[model samples]
Target: MTGRAHRDSEADRIWQMLVGLVWETRGEWRRKVSEATALPFSRVRILWRLVDEPKTLTQLAVSTSDAPATTVAVNDLEDRGLVERHPHPDNRRAKLVSLTPAGRRLIESARRTVRDDAPPAVQQLSKTDLAHLRRILERISSSER
Candidate 1:
C-alpha cells in the first residue's frame, strides 16, 4: 500500500479502537448509574443536562436529539416528583423544567456511583499513564471545536 493509504488504514484502526472503548465504558457507566439511581439511562441523561439550569422542553429535546422521547421522559420525571415545570419568564407559552430537591439528591448519588465505579481497566492505570492519556484525550477533544 502507498504511504497515504497505510496512514489512513492505521488511523481507521485507532479510531475504531477508541470508539469501541468509549462505547464499552459508556455502557458500563450507564448500567451502574441506572442501578444506583433506580432510573433509566435516558432519565439520568436528562437529569444530568438539567443540573446546570432549567431548560424548556424544546431545549431538552434539542439536547437529547429526540423531541418525542424527551417529552415522554420529562413527563415521567415530572410525575415522579424528580422534576418540575415552571412558567418560562420570557415565553408565556413555554415551561422550563428544573430538577427538584429529590432529583438533585439522585443526581448526586449517580455522580458518586459513576466516580467510584470506573471500569477495571481504567482503574488500573498508573497515575503517570493516566496523565498521559488525559493529555492525549484532551488534545483530541479540543480539536473538535
Candidate 2:
C-alpha cells in the first residue's frame, strides 16, 4: 500500500479501538447504575438529564432522542413517585417534569455507583498514565467543537 493509504488504515484502526473502548465503558457504567438503582438504563438517563432543572415532555423527548419512549418512561417514573409534573408557567398546555425527593435520592445513588465503578483497566492506570490519557481525550473532545 502507498504511504498515505497505510496511514489512513492505521488511523481508522485506532479510531475504531477508541470508539470500542468508550462504548464498552459506557455499557458497563449503565449496567452498574441500573443494578444500583433498580431501574432501567433509560429511566436512569432521563433522571440524570433532569438533574439541572425541570423540562417539558417535548424537551425530554428531544434530549432522549425518542419521543414515544420518553413518554412511556416518564409515565412509569411518575407512577413510581420518582417524578412530578407541574403546569408550565409560560405555556398553559405544557407541563414541566421535575424529580421528586425519591428521584433525587435514587439518582444520587446511581451517580455514586458510576463514580465507584470505574473500569478495572482505568483504575489500574498509573497517575502519570491517567494524566496523559485525560489530556489526549480532552484534546480529541475539543477538536469536535
Candidate 3:
C-alpha cells in the first residue's frame, strides 16, 4: 500500500477500536449503575443525564433517541419520586425534568459503584494516560458539535 493508504487504514482501525471501547465501557457503566441503584438500565441512563442538569421531556427524548421510551421511563421515574416534571417557563406544552434529592443521591451512589467496580486494568491506568485520554476525547467531542 502507498503511504497515504497505509495511514488511512491505520486510522480506520484506531477509530473502530475507539468506538468499540466506548460502547463497551458505556454498557459496563450502565450495568453497574443498574445493579447499584436498583433501577432499570434505561431509567438509570435518564437519571445520569439529568444529574448534570434539568432537561425538557422533548430534549430528553431527542437525546435518548426514542420519544415513547423516554416518556415511559420519565413517567416511571416521576412515580418513584426520583424525578419531578414541572411546567416549562417558555413552552406550555413542554415539561422540564429534574432529579430529586433522592435521585441525586442514587446517581452519586451509582457513579461510585461503577468506579469501584472498574476492572484491574482500567483502575491501573496512570494519571498521565487518563488525562491525555480525556483531552483527546474532549477534542473529539467538541469537534462533533
Q: What C-alpha lDDT do the candidate models reach, one value each?
A: 0.91, 0.90, 0.86
lDDT of 1 by residue, 1-145 (tens): 9999999999899999988877877876778889999899999999999999999999999888688999999999999999999999999999999999999999997787676456688889999999998999899899987
lDDT string, candidate 2, 15-68, tens digits: 999788778778766788888998999998899889999999999999886889
Candidate 3 C-alpha lDDT tens digits along 10-128: 99999998777667667766777788888888898899889878999888988786899899999999999999988888889988899999889988877666774555566699999
Best TM-score goes to which candidate? 3
Clashing pairs in 1: none
Clashing pairs in 2: none
Order the candidate numbers by TM-score, best to worst.
3, 1, 2
Indicate the TM-score of model 2. 0.73
TM-score of 3: 0.78
Candidate 2, RMSD to the unseen true structure: 3.4
Comparing 1 and 2 by lDDT, which wins?
1
